[model samples]
Target chain A: MYTSLFYKEWIKTRRPLLLLSAVFAATVAYILLNVAKLYQANPVALWEFIVQNNAAQAGYLKYLTLGAGIALALVQLAPEMQNKRLKLTLHLPLNESKIVGSILWFGIVALTGLYLASGAILLAGLTVYFPAEIVSANLLAMLPWMLGGLAAYLFAAWICLEPVWRQRVLYTIPALGCTSLFYLDALPGAYLPFVPWLASLTVAGFAFPFYSAIRFKQGVQ
Target chain B: MNAIIQCENITHYYGNRLIYENLNFEVMPGKILGLLGKNGTGKTTIINILTGFLKPRAGVCRIFGEAMERLTPAAKSRIGLLLEGHIQHTYFNIEQIEKFYSRFFPKWKREAYYELLKRLQVTSTQKISAMSCGQRSQVALGLLFAQDPDLLILDDFSMGLDPGYRRLFVEYLREYITAENKTVFLTSHIIQDMEQLIDDCIIMDYGRILLHEPAAHILNHFRRFRFTSDADEIAPADGTLWHTEKVGNNWETYSFASAADVQRTLADGGAAVSGLAEERLSLEDAFIGLTGKY
Candidate 1:
């Protein structure tokens, strides 16, 4: 039954998933090509640039990482919500949480795998670019960013279903609040990289599969 | 025979309006139990409650003698439900669904699915998104019967089906009930389609079980009664009777429970009780007679 569920997921999700995988491969290749072009042209200047802008570079990567999470939520989970096909799985004999969880986790794994493959290619290009550049062992040692993208997507999907049009305003409230806190410089340092909305998405990435699963088990009338 | 499905006083409320109140009924095993009501009479609500889809506001329902909320996998495995519309993922083709369902339903017979597919004219390779409404309905039925459940619950049956498919469906349903002798709990406003197959019926109107009995018994007892003058209007059993409007100058009252009791009441009311006969009732007529207010 579990395999069947996963198979169903693969059949339904294959197109978007394939397109994303292709995107991952292409983007990584381009990044590697750019790194090689700069390294061979001016090795001294490229090494100095890396040392000077390491934080900015990491920040940019973090932003890109966040984008990955966002894409995972929308691309993988949103369509199911909009189409209302989740009800079909919900009505089935399987546990609601388990089914949704499996789907969410499945997307997470796929996104992570494709992204890591791209990153590895990019890292090889970086190694060829400037061998003498100071590589931060500590920053590299930090844990992989938890892509709670699937979770957020599921949460947003759940919120999106409410019949009330005013419920949409709920999105703006969080966005505005987050901006105000960031402007005030009150944002905590440890959680700086993982934005609240992203965190919610990540949380949704984890929690929604279970919660939605329970709701799914309730079945459709 | 033991009741395989029991609805123990299930009362549901939609905002301020009550749908069904203290609706008590039980469907015996291997019996075709039909639920008959007019549109919006809460038949679907009752069905949703039975399948554990929509939660009841007041009481619990039991399937195969166990509470539906606590339904075991083995219990759910034995019951098949086909809702009003097709419930499969449309993105998937018929072959994919057939393959997927083969894993989920333990009793799912692949040979039986294909057999029904052939008989029903459903192609396994047809995508659900591309199939016409009639074809989709067929696929749903095919999946349902393929599971070989002990209890089959069908809601709003014959909606999208063309005449040919309708005939085929009825024939198959009739055969299943008679040969396998499984319990069928079906609800539809189109009562005549399923009326012939039903041994028992549970009905609702104005948020109460207006009638619940064997189809023959309800037909035999609780008929249209004609009475002349105000002096002839007899009190019915605790106000359970319905008044069916005028025929010439006399008033007609339809009362349920016991014909003998109703006959005695008319006799005691000091009026002419000359017209006493069973009205040749269609399921439609019985529906209006019990539920309609004149």
Candidate 2:
């Protein structure tokens, strides 16, 4: 049953997922090519500049992950809400909670795979021109942004699953507030100490969609 | 035999406005019951509550002897639902949707679905979103038939269909239900189409049910009586006649009473009756007569 549910989710999301993947790849390639050009011009100066200014050199990738997360959730979930189509899904011959959980799990798993591949490419690309310390630092700096992206996906699910427009607007305030914490500082290692808290927030975001699903089942308007 | 669908004293409100109160109805096995009502009379509301999408304010609905709000998966498997507008996952192609739904149902009838789809000029790879309203309705009906549920709840089945599609739907549905002895509960604004399909009906007025009887009974018993009177005014007692309108010397009213009884009642009300006639009504006329064509 879960596999079938995932299959439906995959059908709805595969197009947007592919589009986001292309965008991610182009963004990563653009960031890496710029880094290569700078290294070719003067490798010592680039390293000295990075060490002194604590620049992650991947600032352009900041909102790219977050946007991917939000886009994936919309493609995966918006169809279910259209024309109150979720009623058809909820009416399926399965436990409603299990059905909703499977849908969310599919989106989360898909997003995780995309993020890992994109992050890995960025890490490996930088390793060729820089030492291990700078590569590790760059990876750490982007970690919170990726976590923020996951949180945004879950939060977007909550908003889209909401049955009422007014309540959805109300939910966005808190969702935006919580996700903002992931971008407080973009410097390398700055978010390392707050990683646990951000991860906790992402975990907590998963529960919000269930609350919305409950309201949807209750026919709140 | 237990009722396939039952509702006890369902009361509901939208904010301060009351949609209905103490509303009650039941659908017995092998019976196709149609809920007929004007706009905002809680026809779809009842469907929503029965399917557990909307929680009523003051009552419980049970399907197959289980509370609607907590229907087990086993119970859910025995029911099929068609939402308003025949809504489905428009993103999926014809074949993909079948593949998606076939996994969950133990009794999924793949041939039943394809048999209906064969009537349409659509390919297996065609997306449902690209279909017209009529075509979408066919797909929805095909899916419901494929589910092979014991009870089917359809909301506004005839909403967007042309005459040809409507006839096709009613004929197909009636044939299927008769062959399988399936119970059906549905609503439609098109009373003529419903007349050819429904075995029984629940006609609803605002906040209450006006009548619940077999379609044959309403067609055979309830009628319109027109008479010419010489008196200046003719007014029968309130309960004896409905929507009485007097134009010039002709008077028209509707009731379940016989022509003799109507004449007697009008004579007692001090009107001199001359030519009196009772006219048989179609289901649409009967509906309008009972509910006062407002």
Candidate 3:
């Protein structure tokens, strides 16, 4: 059952997913090439700037990943809400909760995979010249952003599955607040201390979609 | 035969406005029960409740002897629903939707779905969103048949279809219902389409069931009688007379029993009647008379 659902979601998301991946790869390559150019022009100055100034060249990834995650969730869920096709989905023979969980899980898997791939691209590009510790620090700084991406997907699911506009606006208040927490500061390794708690909170947000589904079933709108 | 779908004292409200109150009915096994009502009479609300999409404020609905709100997955598997306007997962192509649904139903009839699809202009790769409303309706109908459900609840199957498509839909449904002998509960404003299709009907008005009877019985027994009477004369308090209206000097009464029964009712009420002739009515006329305009 989940296999079929995954295939269904894959069909819906394959185009956007490929496009996003291409864009991520291109962006990483561009950033790496620019860094390389700077290094070749003035290697000593670049090294001093990086070491003394704590320049986070990879900071662009924070919002980029979050945007990708939000777009991905919208691509997956907006149609279901717009035309009320979720009603057809909920009528299927599977347990309603299981059906919802499966769809959300598929979106999570795809979003998480894309985030990880983007991270790998950035890591590989930076590791060519940067020291191992700098590369590791840059990657660690991305933790909150990665967590933000997942939370954006979950919150988008919550917002889209929500039937009433008034309640959706109310939900957005907290959703915006939650998403903003990940971008507090781009300092390298700043989010490391809160990593465990942030991850726990992101995982717990999955339950919000189920609550929306229940309200939808009850004809809340 | 036992009841397959039953609702007792099903009352519901949306905010301060009551949608329906103390509504009650049942669809017996192997019966096609058509729910007829004017717009805003809570037909769709009842459908939503029956499908477990809405919880009524006051009553219980049972399908296959299990409460609707608590229907198990196994129970849901036995019911097929064609949603209003033939809503579906419009992103998927025909082949994709077939594969997705076939996995859920153990008795999925792939051939049945494909056979129905063959009659349409849609190709296997066509997305449902790309198709016209008529073609989409066909796809929705095909998927419902493929599920092989024991009880089919069609909520306004003829909503957007042209007359040709509506006739085709009813014909195909007739053939399937005869072959499978499954129970059906449906709602439609197109009374003519249902005239030849439904076995029993429940007509609703103002949150109450106005009439419930076999189609043949309703046609044979329910009659419209027109006669000249005093403007101030009131209609008889007869339970069999569903409605009465005064137009000019002519009084028209919609009776649920027979012509003689209505005459006896008028005489008993002591209202002097003249030219008490029965008027022939089609199902649509009867529906309008029973529910009234506006």
Number of the top candidate by TM-score? 2
Per-residue error at A111 for model 3, in Å? 1.0
Q: Where is model 3 more than 4 Å wrong at Cα?
A: A48-53, B230-233, B267-270
Per-residue lDDT tens digits of candidate 1, residues A1-221? Answer: 78887887778668867776676666656655555665778867665755555511222233344455456555555545543445456556676556666776676676667656655555554555444232232134111332332333444444443323454466436534432332222212344564565455455435534543344445322
Report the lDDT of model 3 for residue B288: 79
Each candidate structure's TM-score, on Cα atoms with residue i matched to residue i, is: 0.79, 0.97, 0.96
Docking class of 2: high
- Report the error of model 2 at residue A9, Å: 0.8
Candidate 3 chain A lDDT trough over 10 residues, lowest sum: A49-58
User: Could you arrange the candidates by DockQ from highest to lowest?
Assistant: 2, 3, 1
Worst 10 residues of 2 chain B by lDDT: B229-238
DockQ pick, better of 1 and 2? 2
Better of 1 and 2 by TM-score: 2
Residue pairs that clash (backbone atoms under 3 angstroms), model 3 = none
Candidate 3 residue lDDT tens string, B177-241: 98999899999989999997899989998778988988888787667889877747656676767
lDDT of each: 0.64, 0.90, 0.86
Query: Evaluated with lDDT, which candidate comes out highest?
Result: 2
lDDT of 1: 0.64
Sort every candidate by lDDT, greatest first: 2, 3, 1
Stretches of model 1 off by over 4 angstroms after superposition? A37-88, A131-151, A157-205, A212-221, B120-122, B220-241, B246-278
